[model samples]
Target: MFLIVKSLMLVLMILMVLILVLNLCSMKTFYDKEKNSPFECGFDPKSNSRTPFSLQFFLIAIIFLIFDVEIALLLPIIKTYNMDNITLIITSNFFIIILLLGLIHEWNQGALNWLK
Candidate 1:
């Protein structure tokens, strides 16, 4: 245990010294607008590169992904349906209930409405 601890300490100390040396040797630069701006064919950009994104689209996509993954997880339950295991059936039913509840909650929250 002592040898293991000593080796770990040596490795950590080496890493810390290397980090400190790299930081001390690096060149620091001040921010400049021209340097940061998007370059297009060595000419000034006509418009801003960054644009505002719609949060609604992101939320809907996330919800879709969640349900999609749940569907994938449910596929295996169908394959195991003939196993005649009560515990497995009960657990899968509970999982389906939870997913259904989540879907209902999202629907109530208007996440499924695209026209909003």
Candidate 2:
């Protein structure tokens, strides 16, 4: 315990010295207007960074999240279920039925169409 405390104190003292040195050095330098501005793509900086995005991108992302979560839920059950066992087979089938229902709903809503 004494060794651990001593080591921690040594580390803290080193960090404090480093911070003091950095602060002293930073005070000697002067910062300009551009230095404070948010850096852009290394290009000559432009003004309009907050342009509106497309709705289609959001729609596709949301659809992907929905299906991805469904699959994530499915995979664990698939791992647990044994095809040769009857009770597990029926439970897995019920899960599949619910997943199929969700798929049919998405299909009817034209969410499955990529070209639209």
Candidate 3:
């Protein structure tokens, strides 16, 4: 058993060294114009970085995050659900109702609209 364990450790060390050597041997030294450029979100990163951000997209993202957190908050109530617990049910229901009202308010305000 001792010999087998020692052999396994030796094999693992050899394999690790082999992998490191192979990776270093295959490393690319070539520089690339496109590959090195920053991520192009809405405007060119290589050019002017002072491009105007879309506020409409930002508003939609904020609304999405609000709903996302609302779902996160609501999920725990599902796991703790008990018909005998009347107040918990009432409280969760009230929470859902409030979320729905907020959603409706956002909808009425046209904040949910994607295209102007």
Best by lDDT: 3
Give the number of the best model, judged by TM-score. 3
Query: Ten residues in a row with the worst lDDT in model 3?
Result: 27-36
Choose 2 or 3, whichever is better by TM-score.
3
The better candidate by TM-score, 1 or 3, is 3
Cα lDDT tens digits for candidate 2, 17-106: 999999987754456677776676554456565666556666778878987898798778857766667777788788789888988987
Assess the local accuracy of residue 67 in candidate 1 as a C-alpha lDDT between 0 and 100: 92
Put the candidates in TM-score order, highest first: 3, 1, 2
Candidate 3: clashing pairs of residues: none
Q: What are the TM-scores, per candidate, against the unseen true structure?
A: 0.51, 0.51, 0.68
What is the overall TM-score of model 2 with all chains considered together? 0.51
Go through the candidates in order and give each one's C-alpha lDDT.
Answer: 0.85, 0.78, 0.87
lDDT of 3: 0.87
**How well does model 2 score by local distance difference test?**
0.78
Please give the range of 10 consecutive residues that has the lowest summed lDDT in model 1: 41-50
Off by over 4 Å in 3: 1-18, 21-33, 80-83
